[model samples]
Target: MRAIAPQPLLDLANVSKMFGGVSALSDVSIRIPEGRIVGVIGPNGAGKTTLFNVVTGAFRASSGAVTFADEPITHWPSYRIARAGIARTFQNIRLFASMTVFEHLLVAQPHQGAGIRRFLPARRADPEAWRRAEEALAFFGLAAYRDRIAASLPYGIQRKVEMARALTARPRLLLLDEPVAGMNHDEAAELRTLLRQLQDRGLTILSIEHDMAFVMTLCEMLYVLDFGVLIAEGSPAEIRSNPVVIDAYLGSEA
Candidate 1:
């Protein structure tokens, strides 16, 4: 008997991106199933962030297809892609300079409907947005910092606030770029637990991380990219032992 595979929540088919004449991504294909945590690891200049940009419609791929939730979004604009149940955090934390942590979350909920209304400020009277904001705040253990200006918070807490802001959108697919870039051990571990909880609740996550230990322990599958090419992919144990991965990216870390 043959077991059927679950349809992928997100699929990138032979995707490539070009910057003028330079190639940023070259015929890369990957698929992520729903409710799973996947990691992409590579050294600096490996096109990891570029890959993220393409997925989020920050850049249009020169070729290939990006299908999410069974729909092809290859030519969609960034805002349209985001409104279609995908949300992401940048490699560098992006927070509203003068907004409080709670306010940041409140402003991040997905705007419904079309027209000039979408560009207007979020409705302060919307209870559902407020509820989601509070839920994200509590889930991220950010209650104490709720009233503080988001940009003025400590580095680690700012990270939490950014993640919380993303969650308020209630995205089905969450893309994290170097999510644990500046955290201490305990903070990173706490994030691992939090992400697992989100996964258990059926949220799909894809992250690009240089923190090998964090990625190794947290991701169920890993993809290795080097010089804009996907060089390897496998389970954590297999990736650790893969000679090409060690030579190209992991080095002594492997």
Candidate 2:
């Protein structure tokens, strides 16, 4: 008999959430492998973002389990989850409008010193964090714009800065919600290449996106959600071919 491979880097087991009488997710389960980009796609109000929130601990699930690195972390707080090696971006860009691009990266740097004492910056300390921040700026091709105010940049650049801030966390699992939501085709393609580079550096990305073509190039696998249930799961080609997925998402195309 052949042996099965190891478990996924992240797993959701029978997970669910509800608001009043409405269930956002119902008994959903998914497994994400290491070093692979997974894309989530669905129509509006399909519980895509709700699933991300549940995994990142922005909200507690009404039932079921979420596991990272094989350890359960369903109810942990958002900050705790971040420290636990999970980091995420918003469906809408959320950045400190008044802060400079450099400051944004600095703030997301990991806390090196211990406790409250760490809050106060020493006259001289940890050059490592600063190095990482600068490296992040260059990684996103924003080293030239590092001094600019974040909000002052164009929308496309703001998106790049938002992603750079998330990278500053150096997360094991990067969750992106519509990172290319509002962009011209050229800009979106550029962002896709950046994400591919990040994944090549060993970032595990789980993204929610509407641009089917964009997702086709980025994701190694795809999961479809509709009315809070997982309707399909497969490679990009398989997802494109699945009739039910087409029916649920592309009505006439199905």
Candidate 3:
């Protein structure tokens, strides 16, 4: 018998997003198979973040559809999409100013049927939330910084905290934007290992990254976008040599 292919955890079918007269994503279609690490690469203004926004329901698509876990979620609200087991970290680290690493994880636990109250910090989180938060803390090796204010930590540490917080939500699909943006060589390498570990745990990840070295080595496959359009996609070896990709985005980097 022929081997079966994995189902996509997230699928974007000819999705497009428009703002007034400008188009941010133009008929972009991509599929993230279950338990894989996929990366999207493009230069600045390539609409990478816009893609994330549309998928996460920060912005509704002008046309086309998005499916997650076999459910149509193109029109779902941001919170609803999140509650449905999709979580994300921003390109810019968004950590609470006065909250510790552990506190950040506690507050990030997904809660349903709680609207505005969810935004308010909990005086005492439930035992399950504490367990998840603690697991994330240990997974990311952040136990030492658990009591330190998240924002007071170094930039790389803060990035880890953001990821840890996202994980505490217990997402099936995780979207990471510029995950290694400000990290040093060692920090990025360590993150690469951690991400692989997450994938081993059956998490599907879609990330937008400019760090070519990091993306090339870490992702199972890559998609290249230019001016809101997907230009190319393949294994790292294929992308590195594609003329269109090199000319359009990778340039000297490839």
Candidate 4:
């Protein structure tokens, strides 16, 4: 079978967000093609996370607009955005400590309503969804501990589990917020491999990360934001040589 061509999956146009007297983002426009990974990079306080929050509706943009899959979704609620196939992981891990990993995946299936819910999980449980969930866990090699509580996993595997939960929801656009924040080099490398595997399988990813090596390897296009505005954008190699990006990230002494 022939593979389908990738298309524009998520688009942001002149999106700006503010909190009280602070302007977190200004006139930021970005287009993410399907099946590609785009990196969002910046110095501290560049509003990277703020942009994610705005897109996912954690906070409404004070000005400008946002759209997903061609429809206007500027200020939709978070759950609404999730239902629309926008799944995100936090900069810090957020998982139910006491819940088993399988339970986490099951709950993410959404309300199939009473008719579908009552005898559904018992009667084959939508083989496709189960297959996808199992596939994701197997990809991350977490199938062995499907019944384990989330908090009991090792840190590196915990990252995999969190990512697994996100994939279990089957999002079209996955917003990964520093998937390697607290990880060591080896752990980070593993996460990078998982992300690439996700992209190769036709997932569109927008990630916020500080690890330059990870960013350069995973993303073809890089968007740089500084002090609430996008200062530069280009290919990873170009971004590495960009003066504006250097000024934003490194001091002139370099």
Question: What are the lDDT scores of the predictions, listed in order?
Answer: 0.90, 0.87, 0.90, 0.83
Q: What tens digits encode model 1's per-residue C-alpha lDDT throughout 1-254?
A: 53498669999999999999999899999999999999999888889999999999999999999999988999999888888989999999998998999999988875676456555555545667888888888988899988999899889888888888888898999999999888889989999998999999899999999899999999999999888899998899999999999999778554
The TM-scores, one per candidate, come to 0.92, 0.93, 0.91, 0.88
Predicted candidate 4 versus true structure: per-residue lDDT over 1-254, tens digit per residue:
64475436788888888788888998999889888899999888899999999989988988887888877889788888888889988887888878887767766666444455546563275666667767777776888889899778887777778888888888888999987788888877877887888888888999999888788888989999999999999999998899878877845322
Give the per-residue lDDT digits (tens) of candidate 2, residues 1-254.
Answer: 63498878899999999999999999999999989999999888899999999999988999999999877889888877887788888888898988999889888875744556454562134467778888888888898898899989988888888888988978999999987888889888888888888898998999999888888888989999999999999999998988898889956433
* Model 2 misplaced regions, further than 4 Å: 1-3, 116-119, 122-125, 252-254
Q: Itemize residue pairs with steric clashes in candidate 3.
A: none
Q: Rank the candidates by TM-score, best first.
A: 2, 1, 3, 4
> For model 3, how does the per-residue alpha-carbon lDDT over 1-254 read when each residue is reduced to its tens digit?
63486558899999999989999889999999999999999999889999999999999999999999989999999989998999999998988998999999988876666566544556443667878888889988999998999999988789889988888898999999999888889988988888888899999999999999999999989999999999999999999999999999788555
Alpha carbon deviation, residue 211, candidate 3 (Å): 1.2
Range of the 10 consecutive residues with the lowest summed lDDT in candidate 2: 117-126
Order of all candidates by lDDT, from best down to worst?
3, 1, 2, 4
Cα lDDT for residue 83, model 3? Answer: 89
Point out where model 1 deviates above 4 Å.
Answer: 1-4, 115-125, 252-254
- In candidate 3, stretches whose alpha carbon ends up further than 4 angstroms from where it belongs are 1-6, 113-125, 252-254
What residue pairs clash in candidate 1, if any at all? none
